[model samples]
Target chain A: MRPVRISQIYLGLLLALLLYLLPWGGFGLLVRPDFILLVLLYWLIRSPHLCNIGTAWMMGMLVDLAEGGLFGQHAIAYIVAAFLAVVYQRRVTLFNRWQQAGYVFGLLLIAQTVLLILKLFSGGELPGLAYYLSSISGILLWQLVIYSKIKVTGDKELG
Target chain B: MAQPQQPTAFFVRGPSPFARLIFFFALSIVLMAVDARLHYLTEVRQGFATMLYPLEVVASSPIRLYRYVTGYFSGQTTLMRENGQLHLQLTRESVELQQLITTQNENAHLRSLLEVRQKLHYPTKLAEITHIGRDPFVHKVDVNIGSQQGVMAGQAVVDGAGVIGQVTRVYPFSSEITMITDKSLAIPIQVERNGLRAIAFGHGRDETLYVPYLPANVDIRAGDKLITSGIDGTYPENLAIANVKHIDRDPDSPFARIVCTPAAGTDRYRQVLIITAPPAVPQIETEPPATIRKPSRHAPRQD
Candidate 1:
């Protein structure tokens, strides 16, 4: 019913990128959440008219560049996640808060699994279970966002 | 933003998500293939990395501020103790330096007598580590110096204690150092005591290195220090690397599994020196053969 300004989408993505660029190290790095993906998912659910699959691909490209990794690895992973988010965008808005969190958590896991599969194909060593710790942290961060924004106008947009 | 063409449509306003996913996936695969198999994207990657530098700076600023604050508030007693230890270290190192200078002069005279070429003295520049590698799987660090400052890829990086890593990628204002603990790095090293040469490779998952394919009865032992042999032009000879931490010579396997801990505090130190040594092989390649026999095996010194 309400219009989300186009600039707001870009600003949200930019802020997420800044968060992703934080200088994490050692154990901190192990549990760092994927900020860009969380923001992308948020926008995909709230304003699919603007932040669609292409935005995901572009953000993934930027992430790939910053990561100094295989150029398109994140692109594929993000696109896969974005596809799922966009496909279920309408249904997601009607779900209860707990179901919505589960749905978003599932999306994060899917994205990570895609990335992990690509890493394995590229001859990378199989990481331990700690590798999935990022997904858990990401879901927790997503819930934090929900809790922070739910009382305000974010309620209608979040569901 | 435009209103949905179909007023009744809730999520049917855009192109098929399946088509978008398939198209993007294919494009990404092609890009990955090009990046992994070819060198054309190197310059492109460097350009993007340079563009991303500002954000990296902004992101790391908080940690920088925290470090500065902690340093400012550090106890005076601790500072004084550290200063006293440094003074003692300087005094002891100066005595060793005096002896080293005398030996170096004598060695130069002997080299001239034998007409051997003078050893190359590499110039090194100090740099600060700005951040750890973003990817936990990759053992790398970004140092605050780059091509603009004469830092080049393939140059060896060291700390005060020992060798840490090599410069793997150079951007406009910073460079990435792939530490010796990465799977992609291998260094030619020799035992300091017996001069037994072998190659050491990084154990990918952990902060350690291993010497693979060595025989079971190899002369290597626990606590033997490994130093650069300088067979490779990338590093200077005789720099301390890792110490043999354990040797697992299983009866079932023919090769000894030698694990080592790097001498340098690669994770602990934030500053490093990048040795910008000139490439040595090209000079030797340009010269005519002095002797016909064993021409290919020619080294700076006779074996």
Candidate 2:
């Protein structure tokens, strides 16, 4: 019923980070969605004033460190995604839940695609279709969060 | 009638998103350049990662607890069977151990005769896999021990069977191991039969390695074993790396596409050893000069 504070967004980001830190291996790792970006996007769309590109960039660096990959790779991707989300924040309020879901899906893919491009430039091998599966799963997660009554700032409230 | 309204949330003054994007983008570029080119961020990354170590432990505890509980409840029969198998294996290896002792002594005597330097012994620390790579596309695993346990980057990681990977990042309480399946990984290897040397790269998707750029007529066959050659000094000599699974040579291509399945027990082993020594850094030599003697105005070279 109330606008979320900046601190709450930070707390959520930290929680997402913790999730990222959880030990996963084998098939479970192959399917692990990008939790930090998911939360960042959620907050960016819901409360742009609370979380912004800077936060997203910081989280991306953490991911780069965690994955032990090229520095700023994830940071760059997250900031780009956050920029799109912030730019579209006002318009997303006009859309229905499904439309917002589509927008979020696009954002996730954009982040992953940017990361894939950077990785390829660094001489990484082609990871194939499975690399994009995370974005789909991330969208599913966004939808679940939306349906669970955790409101994004723009979702219309019915009387 | 409503009283005069206060300014709404939208009226708040702040930097525009475009400006913020440019600022962060510029900052990230600098960071990426420094991190990629300069290697200046190691200490910074390590300190922050150490600070986040507790959160990592907290987040992983629940999953670990669940696994422990499930294993405890269902492990009785499997444990008994495993115990039986191990007893048989122990009996088999015990016989081999005697032979190994004699062979080791003979090898030592021969090496002494040849005046060869003794191989450096590496101490190892056992660490459990705390988590897999934070990003799905990257192949890495976090081990429970880190700098606190003296883990250093580039230390080879191995499970019970064979090499798994190497430590690429080390935090305070934990370290990240890039699995041999990761695309960025490359290990120097030798064919067991002919001792031919080549580098094996991670296949990026499957748990396999690819020995590309080998000539089509290369003397490698399917089922050929691959092992660490030790020339690079990152991995010890003779550790089983992989076994050749398939070889595809297209008439159009210059090199054969060789695929090999990793021999490491990534699927079965939870605990792995981290070799403590850093891989040896090779010395660099500078070229002497274009001319043997420069024409100094004041001096002439002696013939």
Point to the candidate with the largest lDDT.
1
Determine the backbone clash count of candidate 2. Answer: 3
Query: What TM-score should be assigned to candidate 1?
Result: 0.91
Clashing pairs in 2: A23-B130, A23-B131, A24-B132
Which window of ten consecutive residues has the lowest lDDT sum in model 1 chain B? B2-11
* Reference-based lDDT, residue B232, model 1: 84
RMSD of 1: 5.2
CAPRI tier for the interface of model 2: acceptable
Best by the TM-score measure: 1
Give lDDT: candidate 1, residue B1: 57
Provide the TM-score of chain A alone for each candidate, in the order shown: 0.92, 0.93
lDDT per model vs. reference: 0.89, 0.83
lDDT of 2 by residue, B1-303 (tens): 222323256743588888988998888788878988899998988887777777877988898899889988887889999999999999999999999999988988999999997767778898998776666666777888988778888899987788999998778788889888778899999999999999999877777899988998899999999999998979988999999999998899889999999999765677999988877776666876768756788776578
Question: Residue B70 in candidate 1 has what lDDT?
Answer: 100
